[model samples]
Target: MTQTAQLSPSSVFVVSGGAKGITAECTIRLAQQQPCKFILLGRSELLETEPDYAQNSDESALKKCIMENLLSQGEKPTPMNVQKIYNKITSSREIKKTLAAIEKTGAKAEYISVDVTDTPALQEKLATAVQHLGPITGIIHGAGNLADKLIEKKTEQDFEKVYTAKVQGLENLLNCVNPNQLQHLVLFSSVTGFYGNPGQSDYAIANEILNKSAHIFKQSYPSCHVVAINWGAWDSGMVTAELKKVFQERKIEIIPVAVGAQMLVKEMDNTNHATAQVVIGSPLVPQATELDSELRTYRVRRQMTLEANPFLHDHTIAGSPVLPATCAMTWMINTCEQLYPGYKLFHHQNFKILKGITFNESLAKEHILEIEEISKVSFENVEVKATILSKNPEGKIHYHFSAQLNLQQKIPIARPYESINLEEDNIITTTGKAFYQNGGATLFHGPAFQEVTKVLNISPEKITTECLWQEISDKQQGQFPVQWINPYTIDLSMHALWIWTQHFHQEACLPGRVEKYEQFVATPHNKPFYVSCEVKAKTATSVIADFIIHDRQGQIYSRMLGAHAIIWSMKLLRS
Candidate 1:
């Protein structure tokens, strides 16, 4: 289990727009969880006492009393006047209640009445607070305003008010404190920013800025637990009864106050600093045209460079860095996952390498992954046609790899497979150490790809070997970055086929095609697993085989069925 970075009791938190509503609720909950000092920043000034006319908690009774008092003072009781008076009294009451609640939880609560957008005023107030309470340990940037209008109908002032409150207010807070010293930084974003909503263009833009800023700050200060939660509609705060009805009708999930608060605490307690953006609650419905479009082809472009991926330095072939077939599958699967959220690549079929990406020659610097079509095969399954392509200066596209990917919402059970027996009948000809070191001279791979430790048996029918993967330490993590699949382990499985061809045909080879690939679980490191390479057919130019990685009990971890490798000239290995 991952250890959580719990908050300290001495921690001081500065919350913007925290005196009332959702921010107040979250702040109070945090205080309840860990008794800490909270400096609430907002525009409302806390009233010491309620007026005689507004003493009643009942809204109708209080409004009636206020109207009677206005009449007695020879003042008009118009709807606008009544509402203005009602808002002031009720807002003050809420702020007072929040402060009292925090104090009841054995936490210090101080309300600062200042507009967060006023940079100079905010700085002065925060400076004085820090002098009294010491440096701030965390910040919850929840200051935001909503100006709901279409782009053409929205005014410039509307955009300025909504955008400045979130973007500029966060800037003011960061300027007042040192972000590097902060232990936790939470920015309340919205689903509208992630999935654009109508009549909220300004709001969407402001919230998206918050999300982007969270990433920037987290990267700059790796120790700080920064997260921009793209929250859905909540049951309280700005979500009115009418808004709740609308959301329910649209099938949008409403996050309850208690649930949302608990989730916030959990997020703060999490120690995974790599996660900077988190989306909670149900996703908004996309337009029918987006999902049902017949002509839409999703495209993802990424730069291919050896310098960027340092792992390639250890996957050199013929003394040159070459992209491994496993890494190629990873790129394609990653793109598919990105194009379609909430779905994972369960299986890959017809994965073929039309042309390998060789860095030793004129290779494309940028590659494009295109999902040409998505065919729904069943309610829970979909087949995706994805291809990787590149373009030269002449604008001619070259297809490098293509595959049919099967995506599913749930993981399927692993199918049973046959295992190898290294009994006395099966003669052991060479050890894996000898094969890679000197016995297998045609095989050229760096240390990272050399995972086969011992060869138990080798023949025309099959070859069994012992494999081990060394756990990379933090210092060497940069060279072999973590991925969905271990590049080295899969490379080792492919190496089995190469060894078979080298043993029989005396030819060097590279993985050309894979009939099918299924990954059930991650290959554990620093543990010995057996690889059984069963050759079905072989020729002078190519060798076809099935590879399996399993434990001593024959429980399969992963399988590559019908793996095809193309034979290369002996001169290439000598080079």
Candidate 2:
């Protein structure tokens, strides 16, 4: 059963670091959504009233008044002393504002002054609050301190302060509360922890500990809604003007306070309890800037097998699982996408399946994919050559697949689809069931690869068909998992050509080469889509055709032009 956090008017929440900043903002939003009692914890002591000299004064004016007061008292009005007074007054005001905001939402609010790292002190204080407020139903561990410095320059004290406030603080809170009774737990981690940043080694280490702990906690208490949000730089809170400017200069996206607070509320209400860690913001470092600095060749080795890749079982030929041509394209393109971090495959040319891997018996082998930059077609576009090959124990390399890939940093806009005229079509000769039955034209394919719903119309020159969205299960996927370019869907679009070949030439065929292939949008799976295959040329040995997968409105999803299929021996047509 899906688990969702149950928050009600009687829910009592203990929030560390909830008296100020982003935590306070989210706390207020939660109360607004469901009126509840909140016990806020912080180290800063709140003043009941502002001093007479600090009344009606802004930060700059308040600093001047503080300096003057120090001078009149016969003490040195140094910059350090002035800044200390400024911080105390500002922190007090923020705490007061957060309390008032919660009260305005018709929720009970109380502030406690205690250090989370001081375990005994925190336990004593929380025990008292729980006695009066009933029981703690939730906890938001947001008390984290940052002391950023290079490893060489950092002191022991610097590490202790930042690490204890986050890691030790959470341990203390969990120790004080009854873990099984708690319904919700949110830990505010950071992007620094997820994607390490310079001069923040200690801070990142502390947050990563929280991230892992959250997973462990969820496993121990399956009923609890636990999540550690790896937050990016925000527009408010710890990001000071100087730090904000630095993040902006680095092109790091900042999460606005309103959007982030709403996201927290939504996450708490989400029923997917299995998700323990969620990264809420963009990476601290831009991928394009980091990878574009170098253009180098890359070689990746992988093990391929039917046992590891059960998806191929659905695309069998002659009762033996064989790798589909479209899947090879996906493997090649997926590898190319990794070489350039932020770029995606825009188009590919001359994609050929030279050799096919068939799982006739217990089959397992190692394969290598080599990707090399062939051309830099300006800064926005690039071309790369990719090859998939395997080497035997004797060190003989067997080429399997190769393609020229075109990658673009930006997604290209889709153009209007060229609709096909099926006015003079023949009668429908195949239904989805008949096509997949024994002795059928598609007898070589299994249920998973049989995506064609029905042959709507067929002729010697053109064939139109309807295709189903083949849902792939996780276990069947094995090693060759499905991604954006679904092998089954693309193969369905090409199936029209195979059907035409069987009807006209009475021959078995295999996809040999594709001159060009481009995908503009992801194929919609909510409903069936149409595919049109038009034969441009044909011979006794081979046939060339063009295919397009589109919707009823003529909105194209993908297209392949100049696809050449090789005529194979009829013995290989059926098992």
lDDT of each: 0.79, 0.82
Model 2 CA lDDT for position 63: 91
Model 1 has an lDDT value of 0.79
Residue 527 lDDT (model 1): 85
User: Candidate 2's residue-wise lDDT over 448-559, tens digit each?
Assistant: 6766777778878788888886677767866555655777788767878777787787887889999999887777663798888888999999999988888776777888
Clash tally, candidates in order: 1, 1
TM per candidate comes to: 0.65, 0.79
lDDT of 1 by residue, 1-575 (tens): 23324588788899999999888988899889988999999898777787876778898998998899899999999989998888888989889999999999999989999999998999999999989888998999988888897689999999999999999999989998987678888999999998777788899899999999999987788777789999888888678888887777557889999999888888877758566889988766422112343535788888767666666776665667777877778777766655554455677988999887877657886888888666753335557888989998889999989998887655576765555565433454555556566523735666666667767788789887788877654344343344446767888767777776776777888788989988776677788887888998878788788888887667778888988888887567656
lDDT for residue 252 in candidate 1, whole number 0-100? 88
What TM-score, to 2 decimals, does candidate 2 have? Answer: 0.79
Angstrom error of the Cα, residue 293, model 1: value is 5.3
